[model samples]
Target: MLKPRMIEEKMLILLRQGKISKWFSGIGQEAISVGVTKAMQEDEYILPMHRNLGVFTSRNIPLYRLFSQWQGKASGFTKGRDRSFHFGTQEYKIVGMISHLGPQLGVADGIALAHKLKNEKKLSAVFTGEGGTSEGDFHEALNIAAVWDLPVLFCIENNGYGLSTPTIEQYRCKDLADRGPGYGIESHIIDGNNIIEVFEKISELAQSIRNEPRPILIEFKTFRMRGHEEASGTKYVPEELMEEWGDKDPIINFENYLLQEGILNEEKIKGFRKSIKKEIDENLHKAFSENIIESDTSQEIADVYETYDHQEIISKSNKENIRFVDAISQALKQSLERHYDLVFMGQDIADYGGVFKITEGFMGEFGKDRVRNTPICESAVVGTAMGLSIKGMKAMVEMQFSDFVSSGFNPIVNYLAKVKYRWDQKADVVIRMPCGGGVGAGPFHSQTNEAWFTKVPGLKVIYPAFPYDAKGLLNTAFNDPNPVLFFEHKALYRSVRQDVPVDYYTLPFGKSSRIKEGEQISIITYGAGVHWALDTLEEMNFAGADLLDLRSLQPLDLEGICASVNKTGKAIILTEDSLAGSFASEIAALISEHCFESLDAPVLRVGSLETPIPFAQTLEREYLPKERFKNKLQELIEY
Candidate 1:
């Protein structure tokens, strides 16, 4: 507690000196953060908010690194990308929270779920401000934690005000803990200024959770004496209220309690304060002296893809005919059987086998512990998978349908896609999205939405058309150290079957497979379009057209597309998404930029109609008809 206070005091001087930019002081409420953290086991995870510097110090984060991170030095936790307390270390089992506070609570549920699945007697604790309780993720996280009986502790630091908004303006409840019972979790309120009371209550609650594996919400009724940040003046806080809270300062009260109990004398107190000051000074100097390095590599590549050691996949003895849907099940089964760290999470996945029956029989094969069902909360499902990934565990999350991903869009694009580049952390998560049209599922369920994810950096987008590619690419995605968006075409699930390799095999991303070779026109596409392009070519019996299938969108196979275009001197790009700013447009632009001189005619692009997919089969086919794309291909060949 003294360490954080002392560091904050010294760092505030740095901020004034222009050596640091932002600083959050946990001045008046250090006891709650320190108390809850000090009581936790070392292996247990504690994701601290920016104000919870006491928790960071309690977890033994080095003062030099913390100061360096504050200074935005190259040697800092995030290599200077993150500011203030927005950093975490896997070695210390600390996950950092972003400026947006409530999402980490859902992620903490994931960490706790991992512990439960592994049968580890450990818990995950997450800190948030009173204002954070109003966010939807806070409610979603708590509800899932209750439903799953996860060992998680949500410590709400109710400091009476959220920056400038008072508690009365924030929520109607007298206490934030009162809302926990509504979610079926026990709630408690305690005098956060008293260190002993805070520690004892948290220790008892943590122990009970470890035994029974359930969530508990604890609201530490404390106060933040300082403004939200150093620059944010506390002019809005009435002086009377400030003085009242100042007298109840946690450090001063704890110090007095220790002295009156004869636990510490004046000499020891002076020595402790002096020692911390000296340490802070030395570390502060080290932080400012370090250099800062910045790079635009992620922007240049549009993303960062992980390269791993080549592990030989075990293959089955004989090949067998398998549907694309069955191949996905087999791939998941293979991954779980091979890697103990791998876990599967989705809605109705464990017992009901998901809406598509893709994960059918997984519960019986792997048990309820590994093949688990999640609530309808998409953000929690995706966010928790990130938590599991941070712990060096492989997690495969099913989105149920691609369209529903709009709910979890923030964590998916913001955190999961940026984790590897932002902090050099490998977020090895695969989100299996059932996508594409022609299923008569309408706009809510039958949308092909790969374009939205392809634009996000630090994310790998893989869409396979065949059962062979589905099984192989999925296994490959599992081994990559980057987050992968694995898109499965709903139409192709049962429509296509080939002699699949009944063994462990993996396929590389950014590699295009040639469906056929031709001389006049080259056609490129993916997902459902790949099969459609093949059928159209067979129907036309045109030996003058070439077909290429791009398996991944992020690390796009530009070389293959350019080579085919150069050979044929004409090209056509196909996709299931609408033509306006579609992935096909990006491909067409690439061809025009690279193979412009080789082209004999203008590059043509074809895609679905610019509108939501309709439920009627006739409208759906017209939306992304095979004849429409074939007509464009024939026009390109004629040109």
Candidate 2:
């Protein structure tokens, strides 16, 4: 406890001297970090909040590397990508918190879920503050943890204030632990200032949880001795409250108790302080002298996705006619059989199958442990998939509809997408998104939201048009080390059928297939739009056109798109998304920029109307781009 306290004290001086950018002081709250961390087993994972600098120090992370992280040096854990305890280290079994306080709670549930599935007696511990209890993630995480009976120690540090807001304004309950009983979790409240009490209580709870594998909540009632950060001073706190808490400082009180017991004396304490100070000074000097990170586009791009050796999948002669949905189901079944560590999770996916019956009969084939059903908590389920991926298990999540992705957006875009670049952690998770319209399922159930994920870095976006492409791309998605968003068009689930290979195969991302070769114009599209373009071209008796299907959006077929445009010298990009900010616009922009000199006219784009998808069949038909695509292609051909 004193070691982290002394290191933080020196860090505070560095903050004052402008040697570091900022600091979130854990001055009076060191007991919670030190005690809780000490109580856990070394192999157990702990997700610490930003103020829990003591957790990092307690785990024996090198002072030079930590200081280097804070100083934004190249040798830091994040390679100068983030600051504070915002980065996680796989080596120390520490998953650090993001700026959003409550999300890590769900991640902790994920790690615990993995342990339980593997029949390991390991438990995970996660920390959050009193204010974080108000977040929806807090409720979702606790509910799922309780429902699944996962082994997780949820620690809440009730440090009197959330930034400047008092505890009175934060909640109506007497203590945060009071809400634990509502979730069917065992709850306890402890004196966070008393190091011995915190340690003993946490140790008992951890042991019980490990033995039985159930969720536990511990509320540590303590006070912050400094401002939220150095810049945000505690001026809003009453002077009387500050003075009262000042008298109860954990470090000073512990030192006095040790002295009274004759375990520590003035001379021995002085010597300990001298040695710690010397060590911190030398580390700070080394960290300060380290080279700063430089901007390298190639290196930055390389770090965005992990590299893997491509295995050429030989096409077998065995083929059978299958629907698009069947191809997806076959790919998932094959993946589950091949990878023993893969887990498939979604609402009603186990026994009831799924809303679309995509996973029908999966539970009987794979068992409940592998084909698991989840609550209606999208955020927690996504975070759990990420946690499973972090533990070397592959995870597949099914979004009933792409619209509900908004609820799980933070984990996918913030955590799963950024984990690799931030901490070199690969999240091998695939989120199956059933998107697009034509079945009159209304706005919420039908949407082509592929553009939302294509703009996000460190994510693979696959939108296949036919059954063959769907199965092949899915195989590649399951094998990739990065997070992938597999978009399956709802209308094409059963409407599209083709003779797909029964044997396993994989297709490379960023590669496009040319459906037909022509010279008059180039038609670029994907997903359902591919079928629309094919029908339109055949209906109009237009044979002089180059038709290209972009199977993946993020690792897009830029070279193929440019090549087609250069050959035809005229292009029309089509999509099911809205015209404004649609992916079609991006393709058009790329064509104009890369193949401008070879163009015969201005590039064209076709997309849905800029309005929410309506429930009425007529309204949806008028909104989609299928009718408008013919005119756009004609306009491009004439030009």
Candidate 3:
């Protein structure tokens, strides 16, 4: 606790000196971090809030790393890409908190799930503020934690304010812990200022969770003695409240308690304080002397962003007729049968199979523990899956409809995609989203949202058109070290059937499949668009057009695209996404940039109108009509 205080003081000095950008002070709330963390075992994981510097200090994280992190030095956990406590080290049992406070709660649930699956007597502890309790992720995480019976300790530092908002405005209940009963979990309110009491209560909670394996929510009633951060002034807090909490400061009270117990005299206390200050000061100087990361857009774009390597391996030797959805189910069955660490989670996936009935009979075969029916919470599920990955478990998360991804977009985009690059941690999580349109599921249930994920740097977006490709790609995704967003078109789930290999096989991520070879013009498409182009090509009379299916969206087969474009000398890009800022536009732009001189005609892009998919069948067909694509293809071929 004293070390955290000294580090806070040093950080404030650096903040004023313009050496560091900001600092989140745990001034009056040191007891909560110190006490709760002290109860946790070394193997247990911790997800600390921005203000919980004491938690890191208690966990034995070196002061120099903290100082270097805040100073944006290359030696920092995030390599200076992130600041403050927005960093993590896999070596330490700590997962650093980002500005988004609530999601970590869901992630902690995943870490607990991993420990439970591994039959390890360890737990995952996470911290959040009272204000963060209002976030949807908090509710989702708590609900799932209870449903899954995960060993997790949730600490809510009710510090009276979230930035400028106070507790009164945040919740109607007298205590945030009061809401835990609704989620079927044990909740308790503890004195935030009393270090010994906090430690004892947390120790009991940790033991109970480890023994019984259930989540416990504890509200540590404390106050923020300083502003939210260095940039945010404390003028919004009432003077009386500030002084009142100031008088009950944990560090000051703990010192008095130690002195009264003959733990230390005034001289010894002074010496200890001086020694801690010297350590912090020396580390601060050392961190300042460390190398700073210089921004290199080209290197970042060319080197660090790409995570895939091509491999040509076949899983199956013989072929058997199977539906696209069944192929996916087969791949999942293989994955679960092969790896005990793998868990399948989604809504109505167990017993009820799934809305699409893709996971039918999985529960009976794999058992309930392996095939889980999760609550209707996308964000929390994804976050928890990431947590499972962190604990050396592979998590397979299913988003019922790709359209619902918007609900959990933050964790998928911010946390899942950036985990590998930020901390060099393997986010071995696969999000299976049933995407695309044509089943009359309307805008809410049917959407081609692949473009949204393709724009993200670290995510691998897989959209397979054929059953063979679906099984192969999904199998590959299960073993891949990085995060993968596997998009299975709902329209093609049961509609498409083919003779797929029974044996295990894997396909390269960034490779393209040429369905037909031709001259004159080239058609680049994927998913439903692949069939749309092939079917339209059969009916239309064009000079001669080759159809290329880009299986992977992110690490695009630029080589295949350019080769086909160079031969044909003309191109037509097709997609089911909205024409305005679609992934198809990216393909078109690539051709215009790379194959500019080779082009004999302008590249033609065919996409749906910038309107939501309608429930009416005729309107839907008109929206993404095959005729429009044929018209564009014929025009490009003729030119």
User: Which stretches of model 3 miss by more than 4 angstroms?
Assistant: 295-311, 541-543
Candidate 2 residues lying further than 4 Å off, grouped into runs, are 315-317
The sequence of per-residue lDDT tens digits that candidate 1 reaches over residues 1-639 is 898888888878778888788787788888988999989999999999888888888888788888778777777787767788777788788888888787899889889988987889999999999999998889989998999898999999998789989999999977889999999999999899889999999999999998989999999998888888878878899999999999998888889989999999999999999999888888777876777666767553433445566465757659999999999988899889888998898889998999999888889989987888888888878888888887779888899998998988888888887766666667889999999888898889988889998888788899998998999999988888788999999899999998888878888888898888888888888989988888888898878878898988977999999999999899988899998878888899989999999999998888899888899989888988577987877777666
RMSD of each: 2.1, 1.1, 1.5
As a TM-score, model 2 comes out at 0.98
* Ranking of models by TM-score: 2, 3, 1
Output the TM-score of candidate 3: 0.97
Write model 3 residue lDDT over 86-118, tens digit each, in one string: 877777789988788888999899999888887
Error of 3 at 112 (Å): 0.4
Model 2 per-residue lDDT tens digits across residues 480-541: 88899999999999999999999888888889999989998999999999999999999999
Task: Show the lowest summed lDDT stretch of 10 residues, model 2.
Answer: 308-317
Backbone collisions counted per model = 1, 0, 6
User: What do the candidate models score in CA lDDT, each in turn?
Assistant: 0.86, 0.90, 0.87
Write down the lDDT that model 3 would get. 0.87
Tell me the deviation in Å of residue 23 in model 3. Answer: 1.1
**CA-RMSD of model 1:** 2.1
